[model samples]
Target: MSAPDLLSFAKAVSSGAIRVVDLTQTLSPEFPIIALPPEFGQCAPFRLEEISRYDERGPAWYWNNFTVGEHTGTHFDAPIHWVSGKDLPNNAVDTIAPEKFIAPVCVIDCSADSTADPDFLLTVERIESWEKQHGRIEAGSWVFLRTDWSKRDYKAYANLKEDGAHTPGPAAEAVKWLVEERDVLGFGTETIGTDAGQAHLFNPPFPAHFFMHGKGRYGLQCLTNLDQLPAKGAVVVAAPLKIKQGSGSPLRVLALIASK
Candidate 1:
């Protein structure tokens, strides 16, 4: 297929020839934040206070004063979020090139596996199997691990247990292969973070964040609606707030699906 010009692409979207899917979980105070040890600094939850009412404070308008952590809700992770990427250029949300926000994506569905085992970890063999069916995972494409984990309610979504939250994610080797071999633009998940719940147990810990970002890639968390997309071809739009030197930021995620 020939590449569409910017104007042509706009017209196609405007004409409904291309459909947009909301991949974000709505941000609200009810949404759960990533649980951390009591000793460490924690991310804040979304909060809002209405500053005006039609009767008195503001007759003409209604407004709100809001506060939210950079990583709250559906969010993007910049390279600088981890110490490994601390010295890399354009590592923050504001500094990264805007062109990085849009890219092709590959959806690897591990729904059945994840459902059967809460601690499921994607391995390199599984990724190779996916490639056997869906073609190569091209460099610069967003690779999303679809565990159908987002379908759960707020309680099950986090799946916190005495041992820590039970969740599915890539193994350290898988993360390494995706970053160094497949060269994905980023790794995304339906959970609160790109890494698995038990990732800390791995050597160097949180390999997804460590390898991906350390090498100048990105991540998306709390994503939804992956079942609605094809295994390949969808283009993801993940633009984050340009927070100055910020580690990360909450952002709306959208997927453009071709409707031929």
Candidate 2:
């Protein structure tokens, strides 16, 4: 089969045959960051400093300087983020191939399960069930876990308790299966981190980070608008900032979906 025509694809999007859905969460001071134990260094929240306004330093144009942690808000995680992948070449965002920025996606909706239990874990059995109906997940495609957690308000979104955060994510075995069995491009979540909030209790701890990154796969966190996309046939564009030796970076994720 012939490859898709780039110009024609762009025209389709412009002509409304294809709809683009923004999957990124808005970056703001209120957007919650992952909370680590007190002994660990904490990621900074989004902050902005007014460099100029229409009436100020630059009358012709206005701009502001922003400061934020690489992993703040909706972000992309590179392989280097975890010590398991630290020694791998091209593990950092800047070193990753640009070709990886775009890929096909398979969204597994677990909203009902997550709603029933915030600590819900996406097991291999659940993934198999999804595949049975939607067809097998393709190789080199991103596997997104849609929990509808992005729809919560600030307080509920974080869902932090005295013990820690309460959120849903894939089980350790699921992550390994997706990477080894499916050869997926990556794993994504609508939560602050790719791993479940209580994943620390897992054998390797933060298994998503451990297995995914360790094997040169990627991760996307704090995404939104998964409800706008189909379970399959959606292509995700997740381009992170080219930060040198950086573990991760906030990104503007967009999904291209064909309109029936």
Q: Any idea what lDDT model 1 has?
A: 0.94
* Candidate 2 C-alpha lDDT tens digits along 62-175: 898999999999999999999999999999999999999999999999999999999999999999999999999999999999999999998888899998999999999999
For residues 231-254, write the lDDT of model 1, one tens digit per residue: 999999999999999988999899
Winning candidate number (lDDT): 2
The residue pairs in collision within model 2 are none
Ten-residue stretch with the least lDDT total in model 2: 1-10
In candidate 1, the residue pairs with backbone N, CA or C atoms under 3 Å apart (3 or more residues apart, or in different chains) clash, namely: none
